[model samples]
Target: MIDSDILCDLILANKHKCKGGEVADYIPGLKNANRESFGVCLIDSNREVHCAGDYEEKFTIQSISKPLVLMLAILDNGEDFVFSKIGMEPTGDAFNSIQKLETSNLRKPFNPMINAGAIAVSSMISGASAEEKFNRVLDFIRKISENPTLDYDEEIYLGEKETGNRNRSMAYFMKNDGVIEGDVEEALDVYFRQCSIRVSAQDLARIGLFLANNGVTSSGERVVSEHTTRIVKSLMVTCGMYDGSGEFAVRVGIPAKSGVGGGILSLVPGRMGIGVYGPALDPKGNSIGGYAILEDLSKILSLSIF
Candidate 1:
């Protein structure tokens, strides 16, 4: 087992040097975050957890929740049905950009990890109302985290709603293409609600553990299909980090997701899951400190899947 103390120390030592990556500013609430904030939490295969920095603090999961939602959509609607609304290819476009919709004839959201795809994926959940859909997403997240307390942050949701024009625009496009069903406004509402779900490092690490153990927690409860989880993990490895995914896979070599809220949920299947938070971001909207720590950990511990 990797020494928890050493991993935590490496994070702290590197924390100061990772100060000035891009901070998410377009969102009013996110703009106020402290760039110096940092945290890390690691959950081993046996479910033992280690923590460091601001690991105890909670933050919005943001895009990190996309895969979980995608899993729900897949389980609820089946792979063929969900895949119809999302492609496997990387968009190489900005996550919130509507350019793909305007230009591509395929009309699937390109991939489930992106904002556009996530909105479409969320729309596909088996619920009649936005609130019901929101509850299902929360349920899925809670099951994965094995934490009944996991929940949405309405403050963040409302703020995201106020500033999510890009998402709204994409949802509208998806609806028009007959890709996303139901009302666009309602779908966007549910989608934003999930992205704003609050998660501490422990919560995130547990969720990663769920993924690491093939959608089953250490307690032997199955939260999602092994097939669904495998497919989700495959997508995470290929595209979870958005445009930086390829480089990340080459370097960090873990199935992971990054979020604008300075959170990352990463995992090594059958071994461990880790969560990190650092408000400072890189050009890709991933946490600068979080990404660095995972990169360092992956290399130093020889944990890369590749």
Candidate 2:
């Protein structure tokens, strides 16, 4: 087990940084989050959990759901089919930017971590109805995290649907370019619902540990193939932090995905998984306090993959 004292010190060290950052204001429900909240949970390969502060506080998964959805899309389809629709490279633009979609010669989003690419991938999930498709993704998240009660936040889902004009614009653009097929609204629903799924820092750590184990659950069940996990983790390393991914890699040097809800899911191959939540965000949307905690944790623990 990781020392609780270290985790506590990390929280105290970075708590003041929350004052310098802003909570996500665009999402009406997200704006209600407590800006001073900060927490971290770490799970090792041995299934040991180390946590501090408000680690049990539940929040929407947000963009951190992208990597998991991409995994399911690949499992349902194949790499060729999925990558044919979404490029693997990172975009320097914002996660919701439409400029790249209009400019790309291939007419595909730069990567699955972006809103456009995630919507394209959500369209590819196999199911007769949107509900079936969403349940499939939700079940996958539950199994991997060992959290049977995991569910989406209705308020968060409504907020996303109400203020998701920008996302709708991206989906419509992709549909017009033939990058996504059949019922664009259905695809957007799946994407929005996935983002609205509620999880605590501990839940995120459990999911991260699943990735660290190459898609295997704590009980030794393989939820996804090793090949699929590799692709998802690669995307997390390259595109997970929006435009701030490169800097995160340089500083923390781990495979991590951050959500607008102020959560970061990170993993060290064959070692441990970490989750941090700090609602106050920098201009680029990453949690300022959460980022500081991870940076210090990585240095102190020598957790960098490099």
Candidate 3:
């Protein structure tokens, strides 16, 4: 096992060096975050947490919610039905880019982690009302975090709503393809709401623990099937970092996710779940410091399954 103290020191030591990177200023609400802020937490399969720096600080889940939402859609509808609406390939384009939509005759988006694909996944999550879908999404995060206080950041949600014209456009485009049957506005509402779910590094690590442990909660509770967990983790490894997915897989060598808010959640199956926060981002919209931290730990601890 990797010593908790070693990982703690690694994060603390490297944080100051990464402060010069850009934060996620594109999202209006994320612009207010401390660009120098950094945190890391490691959770075991038993849900035990070891953390350093600003691990208790709340931040939006951001794109990290994409995989779990995709998982939920599978639970709501079978995988075959879900993939028929969204392709599983990783694109080299930017997350919000519309190039693929325009250049290709393909009807659906490439994958769920991208903006267009997320909108498609948003429609598949079973629920009649926006509130119902939002609640179910929150409930799943809550169960994984084991934190009842987990709630949406309303300010973030509103900011995303105000600036989510592109997302709305994406939903509408998907709707035109018969990919989304319900109201476009309602689906976008759920997407933004899920993106706004607030969680701390500790909470995020706990959630990661479930994915690391094959859909079983730390307490041995089965939240999803083993097969479902496998599918979810595969997507995380292949498509979690927008256009940088392939590079992240080669560099980090673990199932991981990057959020626009400068967070990365990573896991080593049956070994450890990690949550990291560094508001300074790389060109790919991932936290520069967070990825470095995880890569170093993966090497030092030999945690890479590959």
Candidate achieving the largest lDDT: 2
For 70-90, candidate 3 gives per-residue lDDT tens digits of: 888888989999999898888
Task: Give one digit per residue, the lDDT tens place, for model 1 in 191-222.
Answer: 88998888887788888989999989777988
Q: For model 3, how many clashes? A: 0
Report how far off residue 159 is in candidate 1 (Å).
1.1
- Candidate 2 clashes between residue pairs 3 or more apart in a chain or in different chains: none
In model 1, the runs with Cα more than 4 Å from the true position are none
Candidate 3 lDDT score at position 44: 76
Candidate 2, residue 56: Cα displacement in angstroms equals 0.1
Error of 3 at 72 (Å): 1.0
Q: Where in model 2 is the C-alpha error above 4 Å?
A: none
Clashing pairs in 1: none
* lDDT (0 to 1) per candidate: 0.86, 0.92, 0.84
TM-score of each: 0.97, 0.98, 0.97
